[model samples]
Structures are given as structure tokens and as C-alpha cells.
Target: MGKATGFMEYQRLQEASEAPQSRKKHYKEFVMHLDDAQAKTQAARCMDCGIPFCNNGCPVNNIIPDWNDLVYNGKLREALDTLHSTNNFPEFTGRICPAPCEAACTLGIIKDAVGIKSIEHYIIDKGWENGWVTPQPAAVSTGKKVAVVGSGPAGLAAAQQLARAGHAVTVFEKNDRAGGLLRYGIPDFKLDKNLIDQRVKQMEGEGVVFRTGVLVGKDFPAGITNWAKETVSPETLQKEFDAVIIAGGAETPRDLPVPGRELKGVHFAMEFLPQQNKVNAGDKVKDQISAAGKHVVVIGGGDTGSDCVGTSNRHGAKAVTQFELLPQPPEQENKPLVWPYWPTKLRTSSSHEEGCERDWSVATKRLEGSKGKVEKLIACRVEWKDGRMQEVPDSEFEVKADLVLLAMGFVSPVQPVLDAFGVDRDARGNARATTDGAGCYKTNADKVFAAGDMRRGQSLVVWAIREGRQCAREVDAFLMGESVLPR
Candidate 1:
């Protein structure tokens, strides 16, 4: 605790954001990080809780109090070191992760929680600015080779750790670029693509090879996002590498199979999102899905849906509306009952602030259109009782919708990759692998392991990194019969 009385003396100050009206005009990050002094003040708010719940709350188990104290004492380099110890990509989490750590903070039970995410953003940005972040190449090279499939957060983290452990690592990505969701799924307005590029350059300098546009399984289905210019067989990887780790994330999106789902204007959120990211990166897409001058209806109330709202606004849509089948949560959570744990509460994203009409407990019945183009949506209100939903009588309604984006989240990993390698799948269709025990991360198949979203199903980037680091340790031990890498 840098300042025992800091909480009483200071009020929480959030990082400033550009006005929605102005920020929506361009596809760039708008939230400004706190300056050094402000960050120090924020860090000082960390209390002397006997057990730091915030640490446990974070998926990667970051040492929050230590870093907060370091930042409060103006030890910028020390804070950055502490942050990097737990999180391989704090820059990504700082920008995008919903801070469950803050929700579990002791201070949040009474007053506002410490602005940990903002402080982390400041620390990492400062580290980069001071040229402190550089490749840490291994001192000696091991003869072993490892193959990491999917260049998302999990694969990248595993590759970095395995390479630093003196093993040869090669990452294969289906996309033309390194980052998976970070490069394409997320809008540039929240995260800049250059940050991903910067890390890729550093990883390359550390002896980790990145093979972009290389698919490692059967060809992906049409309308699914794929930028692969070459295909590599799973058998080849198993034969060439000492071990193979699958981190290809859950790519099968959940679909609404109601009437008129085949309409031309209806698309999955993934189908619409990646195209805009490609356009932002200066690639010309043919017949790109545009929301311009249309009444857009985004189904599913989640980050992906919010992203659609933001992108639609940027596209200068006539109107934007979001729908959620579940009932709305309370605006404020009951802290007394849910302290030190993530609570159910309403969250309003920056996209909603920009412009969006949001409704909850509403379900779509069918879409009506002509000439194979969606024109309107038919929906009804629902009531939930005893964990079951029933439609409300005489509550049917219709709304104009020229474009419908289904952002209802992913169901499981794309099955073809798992089939190609002959790995068993969990009941949920994710790659089956335990996170603990002697065979942790090892799949049913020999010399193959699974981690991140591929094994755990779709999850946060922080969880992906954690799984990656742990899987790397397991793989290293499998290769050398023991491992010195951190868990």
C-alpha cells in the first residue's frame, strides 16, 4: 500500500474518451490513457486487503497490488515488469478486456475500484516508448521443434514461451496477417492494427517463425473467413515437429435458424466484421457488406453486437437497433452479496453511447422480405419464469431492417481442423483436453496438445494467454521430460 489514506483522499478518475459524435467519424482508437501523475494517484488507491481478490479475479492472475504499489511509487519499469510477468499481452487486455478485477476489488464494495486497466495501459505504453520492450532471444538452442496452429493470442503466447525456452517454434495462421481476432474481428476504433504488427516484429526477432496465409487442415467452408494462399496437412506437422499445439479458437458462430434466414441481407457478425477490418488495412473487398443508409438490426447483446453498432454508425446508417433475448440486468449490482466476484450488471459500451436503440427480452420470429433481400423483422416479447421462456400474447411487432447482423457469439471450434488431426472433441465440440493432471493439455492423439479457445471454447483474450502459457509448459515437459518454463 503506497498510500494508506489514498482511497479516502481521492475519487476515482476514469480515462477520458473522445466524444462519440467526433470519434465515430474515423476508425481509430479514441480513449486516451491517463498521464503519469494521474496514473500514480489511481494506483495509490489499492488497499491493504489481506487477500487480493483482484488477482484471482483476473484470468491470468496478474499481481495487481504489487504492480499498483510499484506504479504508485513511480517505479515505471518495475511496474511494467510485474505486468509482463503474468500477461504476455497486457496491451490487448488493457484495451479490450472487461475488468473483472475491478469488480472484485475491495474498494469497489464501498467506493470506486482502482483504475487498474488504465494504469496497465499507461505502463505498457510507457514501456514501449522508452524502448524497454525488446526480443529476449534464448541463450542456447534446443534441437526440438514445436508447431503452433492459429496465430491468435494463445498461439502467439505459446510460441513466444517455447522459443524463449530454446525450442524452435513456428506459428501457422490461415489469415494473411498474424493476429487472429485482434487483427480482424475487433474494429480498428478500439485497437490499432499497428500494435499487433509491432509485437509480430518482436516475436520474429526472438527466433519464432510466423507462416501467414498457411492453412493446416481441409479447406474452410465458403463464406467463412479465410485468407490462406497455401495449405499444410496435419500429418506433415505431426511428422515434422516434436509436438503440435492447436489454438485455432472457436470459429463456428451460433446461427438463428428462423424463417428467411437465407435472405441475402442477413449475415453473421464475423462475416461483416472482418470485411471492414480488411478495408481499414487497405485491402479492396468485392461486394463488401455495407450498412450505409440502411436500418440495421444487430441481434445478440454482447461485445460483438456492440461492435456492430459502432461500425454501423461509422458507416452512416439510417438507424441502429440492438436486440437481446435475455432480460436486462440491473444497472447497479448488489455489492454486499457479490463482493470479490464478478456480478451480473448492465454494461453500456461506447458504441451504445454513440447511438443505438437497445431492447431486451425480445426474440425474433421471422424476417419478411421480397426478391431474396430482407426488408423487415418480426419479433415478440418474452417472459422468463423458472428458467424457461414463454412468448407474450399479443406482443408481436414488426420493424424495418435492411441489414441484419447476427452477433450471438460462437458455439465451438471449426470441426474440420479437429477432424483433420483426429483429435477427440468434448461434448461442446471443443477439443477435449484437461487443464490439470499429468496429461494436462495433451489430446487423445499422440504428440498433440490443445489450448485456449480451441479447448476451452470461445473466451477472453486473457484466458487465451493463460492457457497458452500453461500449455507451453506442458509441451516443454513432454519434450524434455521436465520443464523450467513458468506455469
Candidate 2:
């Protein structure tokens, strides 16, 4: 450890951020990464815990202590190297990942967890500023070709690994851009699109090829956010590539099937989110869904719902309200009972801090409107018993809502893509693939593998990257009968 008793000497320092009133005026990242001295102090608080549960707590198993020590010692380049060893895109995770690793920190059992995510953000950003992050093309060509479906984190990580292993890799994306959900699903304020572009350039330099606006499947359903001008058949990829990895995000959003689901001005979070991202990228969208001047209601209590709240506020909505079907969790967790494990607790996002009316234990009954446009939402408060929910007597209420966004999260991958590949799907409609054993990540379909959300259903980006890297190892071994790539 860099400083044995640093934890006792120094206190945690949170990153600076733009004030709510000012940051709400524009769509730029408000949170600033810690400067060098601040990061070093934060890193020194690692406490030299014997068992680094924070490593396993992270989906990608980042070597937290080593990097923390490196950061504390002012070895910026080595810290960046250690970070990149486990995470292909720390920049993405640093900005968006919920940091379960912090929750699992041994120090968190007593005092505040080490500012691990902040240190990571600082390391990666410094790496870029100093040109430490660059292409790592393999020394020798393996002469194998790999195809990765979707250009989201999982696909991007897989492609980068496979390419660096000296195999030619091509990533196909249905959208006009390569970032999948990262470039479109997340708001620009949270993550700038240029970061995705920067990574794409670096990957291209490392011999990974990206084919945007190219759909691997025959077709996707309408309203699924496809911008493909051309479609490539799954059979063609199977013939051309030595291995194929299905790494698309779970695109099928869980719907609120109320009586007035067909009403206008009521849309899934995906439909609303991507449009704003496109607009931010200077692309004009016809009849784009806007929360401007409307009383907006967002359903669901996850990141997507929080994103809706932020975007609605940016769009200058009259009012914004968020609803959660489940009861709110405790504000704080009992660390003794749940140490080293992610605990269920109340989380208020930056969007909530910006401003939002939040309610829990509420379920929407229906939408009401005239002329086919949603006008109000009818809902009821409920009580839970034994994992079952029952509405409270006479608790029904209605709220004025000119715009309703359903952000309840995704259920599974788009089924058509799986059907086109002729791969088996699990009960939840994700591509059926295991993460372990001799045939791990491999589907029943020949030469086809699955990873990330496409196989695991809706999940965090870190999990996606983890699966992508592991899947790459499996695909590499499958191709050459052995692989040296990290699992």
C-alpha cells in the first residue's frame, strides 16, 4: 500500500460538479473528474485490505488495489495500463457504471468507500490527455476472421480483443453509428458521443473494422431503433467469419400494456432517448418526441427512467414525475449484514437532484385521453405482502400528463435477430448461451457465440464488457484450439 494509515489521515473527496440550475441549461457533462492531488489522496485510502472483494465485485474483475497504489504513487501510465488490462473501455464504465466494487470495498464496512470510480475516471482521462492510450495491434496475424453483431460495449470489447489477438474482426451495427446504446441510449450530458468516436478510431487503428448502418439480421420490428440501409444475412456471416459473437443489447423494452397503450404521446424510453441523442449529434428527426412544455410522467425507477427525467428537464417540461411499482428501499444499508455484496437501497440519480417528483408503491391503471393523445395517467397506490402486491382501497388517482415515457427496462434481445441466426433462445428470449464449460458462450448454431445482454438479458455495461472479453477468449480458443487472450 502507498500509505498504510492514509485512511485515518485523509477523508473522501467527491468530484466537483456543475450546479443544477446552470447545468440544466445545456447538454454537457456536469461531473468533473478529480485532479491529480485529489485522486492521489483518494487512492491512498485503499487501506491495504487483505481480500480485495472490490475486484470480484467489479464485473470485469479490475485489479483495484494495484491501480490504487499506482495512482497513489503518481504512476499515472501504469495505473492506466492496469485499468485497460481488465476493462477495454474504462471511460464508459467510469462515467456510467454504478460501481458495485465500491459497495464491496472492505473499508466501506466502516467509513466511506475509497473513491475508486473517481480514480479510474482520472486515470483514463489523464491517459488520453498524455496520449498513453493507443492502438495495440498484435505482432502476428492469426489469419482468422471474426464477426461481432452489435457495436455496443460487449461487441466493441469482443472485437478489440479478437483483433488484438491478430484475428481480423468486423463489427456490424444496425444504427448509423457504431456505439449501439452507448452513443444513442445514454444522454449526451452523461457521456459525450466523441468518446465513442475516439475509441472507434483507436480500435480501427488496432485492425478492428466497424460497419455502421449494417444490420446482421434480415429485419427488425418497426420502432426498434434500426437505422440500417443495408442488411446482411446471418448465413453470409457464418460463411465468411471463423466465429460470430452476438453481443447486441436487450432491445425489447418491457411494455406497460394498459388499455390506452395505443394512445399517442406515450412512448417507450428507447424511442424517446435515441431521438434526443440523434438531435444532439446534429441530426434532424421528424416528429421527435419532446417533453417541452408538457407535464411529463416517467414510469419505472431505473437508470432509464432517471434519464427520462433529466432529458425532460432539459426539454423544459412544465413538470416531471417518476413512478416506481416497487416499494422504496432503505436510504442506508446495514453494512454488517451485507458487506462485500450489493445491497438494495434507495438511489437518487443526478437527474433526480436536478428536479423530479418521485413516488413508490404505485402502479398505473390506465391512460386517459381524447383524440388518440394521452392526457392523464390513472394509477393506484399499493401495498406488498409476501412478494405479492395489492392495491390500497380508494387509493386511485389521476395526474395530468401530456407526455408519458415508459422506462421499465428491457426484457430481452430483439427476437428477430436470434431467429435470423437460427439460435436457441432462453425463456426470456435472450440468445441461449452459457458463460462456462468447454462449449461456453457458444450457441447450438455452428460457429455462433453470444455474450453480454444478448445472452444475459438486461444488464450493466461492465457485465457486457466482461462477457465480451471472456467470449473473445472462447472464440479465440475455438478458432486455434488454444488461446493466450485473457479470460
Candidate 3:
């Protein structure tokens, strides 16, 4: 929809990044974005596929072709509006999302897909620079109140939508600030904290209330109370608000159990990543865990593991090695069979490009240490056959390791919060809530609902935002009898 034959003439181009040598010296964003003209040319790569699979691929269903055409035609303002119509935070998705839309692009069958994510970043950044992004306060007030229990992307999206639907929305965060994982879990080099602060300010201007350091549950633990600036029980919230949305993210991290698991040098990925982020935010940390001058081994080959790799390089570690239990995926996918769907293929993140050794189909058998601190890892190579994994004979080996970080993902949202609200959980440990029509996002308890990772388990920020927005629509409808908010 951008240009009749633009896809045939142009190739996809993306932003450039600083050299690893230079970028590893600090923890800040190093990618260089395209200028206005370059961005428009990239937008021209969008083709008018009869059926746009890219729309279905996008979690928020962003109007990709329409905005691409607008940008290609040099209609910057309209492009931003169309882009924002479906997604609330293009900036976040642009920077962090895996860009499934690009994977589903019509041209991707034979040629490189449109640089949709880059264009998205350009459109939103340009919108901000030109003062196009502003608060859209609701014209009418419904006088209903909504209590959202998390300040992650999902919780924030839901709260913003409900507030714009004329409902009084208050977001409760257990951390010292809002933007849960965005504030702490993610590295600043990938997404700067200032971007989050900017959107938060805009949300405030739109009449959303943010209460940081507040926990919601019964008999709030004294330890948690001290951690938060304020505290409120679920009962208190039910008594005060018309409806409650539980959007807290999955906080129970999966752990690696083996010999020397209690070693002093071993830490969870969450524990390691957040300290660096807090330090970047000007918070003082005593004797911060330094990968510097040490051999670091990161277990779990997901985004969290990649994050550890990047941070370790930034810390000037002597060596960094990442381990994955599954076998390595194909370097490229067979497009004919996997088109329009996310496929099983190797993905190399920018963090991977920074520098680190990656190994797959290997399992850690145990940890070895002295003085109660991790000193090495005993590992074995495994082979997959008949849908089961078996260790290869004589493949057992040991590698020196001064520090170990487990990035095995999360099991579920904190149990106490779910228990306090009396919401049922699925077999996988996620809150039991469906996204379909009729009782969408509704929890087992009356006047209670669930969304985001808490309801769906670990997922991308884009998916979380989508669920949050859809859940808000359901909550608004339940409170006001009907809702105009988009799902």
C-alpha cells in the first residue's frame, strides 16, 4: 500500500549500531536511527498484499500498510495517527518487539520484508519531536473506579484505556516506581528509561493515577510494607473500586536445582539485571555484582540470557558463555511451511552480536565450588531422539565459572497476590482467564479480572499490551454496561 512497485525497487534498510568495542564500554543505547528521507524510503518497501498477514501478526494489529503509504506519500502526521490508532506504545514495541509483522510481510516470501519496526520507531520519534503526541482526556466522566495491580506495559495500557473511557483508574506498583520490568528488568542500552518516564508523564496528563510502592493483598507482609511506600489489601480495593484488574507480571523465576546451587556467586537473572538498571538510574548500589575480571556463565538461552551476556561484556568480564538445553535451530526457516506464523529458527539478538560464546543441546549437570562460592560447572552434551533427550557417553566436561546467572524464565505471578484475591490458576501456573468475548478477562472471584503475563504466562511486551487493552475494554463494559474502547 505504500507504492505500486516500490517493493520491487527498494531493499529493506535498518538503523545502524555502534561497534561492539565502543558500545561495550558503557550501558547506553548505541543504535543510530535513519534520517527522515531514509525512513520514508524504507516505508516505501511496504507492498499492497491482497490480504495483509502483517496485521494479523502484529499483537495490537497496527495498520502497517496504511501508515507505510502515509509515510511514503510524505504525510507524516496522518501516519503517526494511523500508527497510534491501534498501538499505544509504538516506541516500546519498535525497540523491543521481535517484529512478527516483518516475518509475515508479503514480500518476505522471496525478498526481505519491509523495515516495519524501524519505520515505527521513526514515526513515533518524529511525532514526539513535532509535538503531535498529546493527552486525549475523555470528554465525559463515568464516575466508576478501576484498580490495576501492576505497572508493567499491560497494566499501564489497561489503566490508560480505562481512564480514557471516563473511568477513574489507579495503578498500584510494588516497586519503588512504576514500569515494573521496563523500569528494572530490561537493560537501558536496549530501551532508555527516559522513554518510559515520558509516557508516564503523558498518562498522568491524561488523568491516570500512579501509586508506586503499593502492594495489594491480605495481611500485607511487614517486609513488603517496608519495601513499598504505601499498602492496600485486595478487600480494601474491592470495597473502594467498582472493578479490579490484576495485571501484575509473572514474578516467580524458574530456578536451576543442582549441586552447589546455594553458592554465593550464583544469582537469578532478575537479581543481576535490575541492579545495573537501578545504577544507571542514579541509584547507589554497594559492591554491585561485577562480571568484571571474572568468568561468567549464563544459563538459559533466551532474551534474559542475552541480556546477561550484554551486561557481562559491559562489565568487562574475562569471558562469557551462554548455555541452552535445546538443540540449535536451523539458521534459516523453510518459508513455504512457516509463512505467516512464528517459526522455530535461530534468532540472534543485538546482545548476542555484542560478544559471547553460545552453546545448545547441552545441560548443566552440577555446579562445583570452593568457599561456598561457584567455581566451575559440570556439564554434558545431550542428543534428542524419539522426543527425548539422552546424554552422550563420555561427554561430561567441566568449565571454570566465577559467576553464574540463571535466566530460565518465570513460573508464574507471585502466589500470595493470587491467593489473596482467590483467583484460580491454570495448570501452567498462570491466572485462569480467557481473552475471548463473554466474561473476557474475568477472574473466578466477583468484581475481579486478570491480564498480561499473570494470565498468559511469559510473553512479549506487545502481547502483554494487547491483553491489557482488551481486558480494560471488558472491565469498562462490565462497569458501564458498554464500552467504546478498542480491544
lDDT per residue as tens, model 2, 1-487:
9999999899999899999988999999999999989999999999988999999999999999999999999999999999999999999999999999999998998899998999999999999999988899999999999999999999999999999999999999999998999988999999998999999999999999889999887777655899999999999999999999989999888999998999999999999999999999999999999999999999999999999999999999999999999999999998888888999899989999999999999999999999999999999999999999999999999999999999998988999889999999888898898887788899999999999999999999999999999999999999999999999
Question: Which candidate do you rate higher for lDDT, 2 or 3?
Answer: 2
Question: lDDT per residue, candidate 3, 277-365, as tens digits?
Answer: 87898989777888999999999999999999999999999999999999999999989999989878999988788888999999999
lDDT of candidates 1 onward, in order = 0.94, 0.94, 0.89
- Clashing pairs for model 1 are none
**Lowest-scoring 10 consecutive residues by lDDT in candidate 1?**
219-228
- Listed in order, each prediction's TM-score against the native is 0.99, 0.99, 0.97
Better of 1 and 3 by TM-score: 1
Clashes of 1: 0
Task: Tell me how candidate 1 scores on lDDT.
Answer: 0.94
Deviation (Å) of 339 in candidate 2: 1.4
Global Cα RMSD, each model: 0.8, 0.7, 1.8
Displacement of residue 424 (Cα, Å) in model 2 is 0.7
Error of 1 at 399 (Å): 0.7
